[model samples]
Target: MESSLSFSLPETLVLPLKTQLISSGSVPRSPSKLPFHHNVSLTVSLTVGTPPQNVSMVIDTGSELSWLHCNKTATYPSAFDPTRSTSYGPIPCSSPTCTNRTQDFTIPASCDSNDFCHATLSYADASSSEGNLASDTFNMGSFDSLDMVFGCMHSVFSSNTDEDSKNTGLMGMNRGSLSFVSQMGFPKFSYCISGTDFSGLLLLGESNFTWMLPLNYTPLIQISTPLPYFDRVAYTVQLEGIKVSDKLLPIPKSVFEPDHTGAGQTMVDSGTQFTFLLGPAYTALRTEFLNQTTGVLRVLEDSNFVFQGAMDLCYRVPITQRVLPRLPTVSLVFRGAEMTVSYERVLYRVPGEERGNDSVHCLSFGNSDLLGVEAYVIGHHHQQNVWMEFDLENSRIGLAQVRCDLAGKRFGVAH
Candidate 1:
């Protein structure tokens, strides 16, 4: 029987930069009880093991293997203690799941001296989790508990300390065999992220969401042949062109095509915080954006003004100005549909004390080339207030603009 479930994502603030921006009133906030914070990531709560120990996990569509910090380390106090769970069963190295089913992972599964299936999962930010593959009962607010496979990470290495400690683990929502959505046998799942509070609703299985707004769909691209650096399991989509203020850029369509190595494809990733584009696409966008904002806003030409070595197109705003000048809209034209990004989503107000008297706002889009990945990624910031549905059965992605806060209230998902 097919089972459907709903999860309410509560906002948890992470990343010092975003925290400062929210505190400084640079980012908008709501006065309601469910106030929205510009959180770096969205997290959902779930119970694990026999006694049902609660765990908070980040929702990451870009990744496949779900994992949890295990065996109380000095750093992680809320880590899952597998020994305490009566139903905890570690898969042996001889199991097919450890050998053949780990293809979705960047690193192959290995056998430890204890004869258990060991796996190492790596991320784009150079962080990694080394752990053993194990099965446990997951109670995700469903009528019945599910026996699911996940990683019990013993050691985690992360470059960003502030971002890593926010969540107990990550719940991978990708299309891989071991992902939460795939393991649950869900044909379709939908999520609506509130632009105001960053709180959202995640619905698993076929659910009607068109009552909010009409959804426009685009076919999901599949990579038949795999390459070393290319991610074959991502939610890949065909990007045809880009339009700044409804005017299409002069870039050719070939620039968006994947090379023989399968590198230049575009992916819709919730794990990434900011949108990133290939060299050609990013350059054209930056040039046109600067050309449009020349007279309206003061440009910040300082070489040190770059954020994360990707966002360099910055503008200075007086601290006294409560309202920002009108900015152009950016539209990402996909094969069958286009996503129009509003002016607020296009610019990120820089947070720090270094900007003497004026506030700095930079283009939220970044150059993907800096990450050495020749591809485009649409991040969560661009997905705000959007109802995104991943229809696995039809192999397509559906998108619609919605007031997610209201959606959450209507669905009784708001906390």
Candidate 2:
């Protein structure tokens, strides 16, 4: 069945955003504490089909392949129909495009009666999808790309249904050949996240403006030697230290480092909502934070030594509209640069429906005790008001503190 949702496609096409960001509905809460499975990932609006059916999807840099969660049953707000598009075709299971689950630890796929690629993706958050892989036309604005391959999911499962309402699928932006970024061949891309608006700008390809702006460069580290499963899977940056205000917190760099046997280094995830620090790293951060703002911030009652304990460092503030003095600008000190986390971005406003009051906010940073001391994740929330550029070609990333204007976007398609 064709969807009847009315939305206008952008009139501009050439420099169509291979990496764009938008927002959706959902209440983000701790998975164990509440049923809300909200994410702060940047969502992109996809224009699919001949007439162009618009669908929202999450921009997951950690994932390798892009897939649309299909359900004719209205389980997903939008889905791609290969049968309807003349440009659509399936990849045979024998093709290199079709990978085995055990071979490279890639997405799990099986051959159907027609020998088409059928795959399943299971995430750490209990979100999963089982589907058939196919190729078709992918359009954004006026720009059109032919024979792009993606997944048409048969069934999708997530811990939160509200998240499904926000996005129909995943737009994997990893270094894998199947990812949207690789398919587009835009090695250099940049984005700026808004701390206040929760909206941002995405610019793909080379630009002269890159040199004009003051940018701090850091080497993008990868897994020592990569297999298909480990190659350019995530943006890993070496974090040297974390500073609260003018004082640098006394936490060892080893506390933030990840085992090379694992994903390697600290990760920069645009899809994850909250920043996660390991046990020792978190303890030092929390203790220092509380010690500095002792009387300024009041810890919530019925909570453990560190505010609400493991899950968060919540506080009861008398905030209605103005910024509170209790909130500090947390900085993530990287190898080549330091990123100042905005006070607004560091704290989350507890929804009024839960506590029946709007005065409570919790730190977006969380303890990763449950996941073990694996790696530190600098999530989307912590990157607010910062312009982060991913230079895949050079294996480096540039960061700067500034809000970018989205007007007068340049458009061009590389042949």
lDDT of each: 0.79, 0.64
Q: Any runs in candidate 2 off by more than 4 Å, and if so which? A: 1-39, 100-107, 210-212, 226-232, 304-310, 319-321, 353-358, 371-373, 405-415
- What total of clashing residue pairs does each candidate reach? 1, 4
Name the runs in model 1 displaced over 4 angstroms: 1-38
Q: Write the per-residue lDDT of candidate 1 for residues 1-415, one digit (tens) a residue.
A: 2434343322221111111112112332222122222367756555799987777677799999999999676666658889889999999999999888898788889999999999999887788899999999987542356788999999998767576675678889898989987887778777777776666667666656457777889999987777765688789999999999988999999999998888898999988889999999999999999998889989887987678778889888888887888899999999988888998888888877236678888899999887777789999899988889898888999998888777776765434
Q: Find the candidate with the highest lDDT and give its number.
A: 1
Model 1 reaches what TM-score against the true structure? 0.90
RMSD of each: 5.8, 8.5
Cα-lDDT of candidate 1? 0.79
lDDT of 2: 0.64
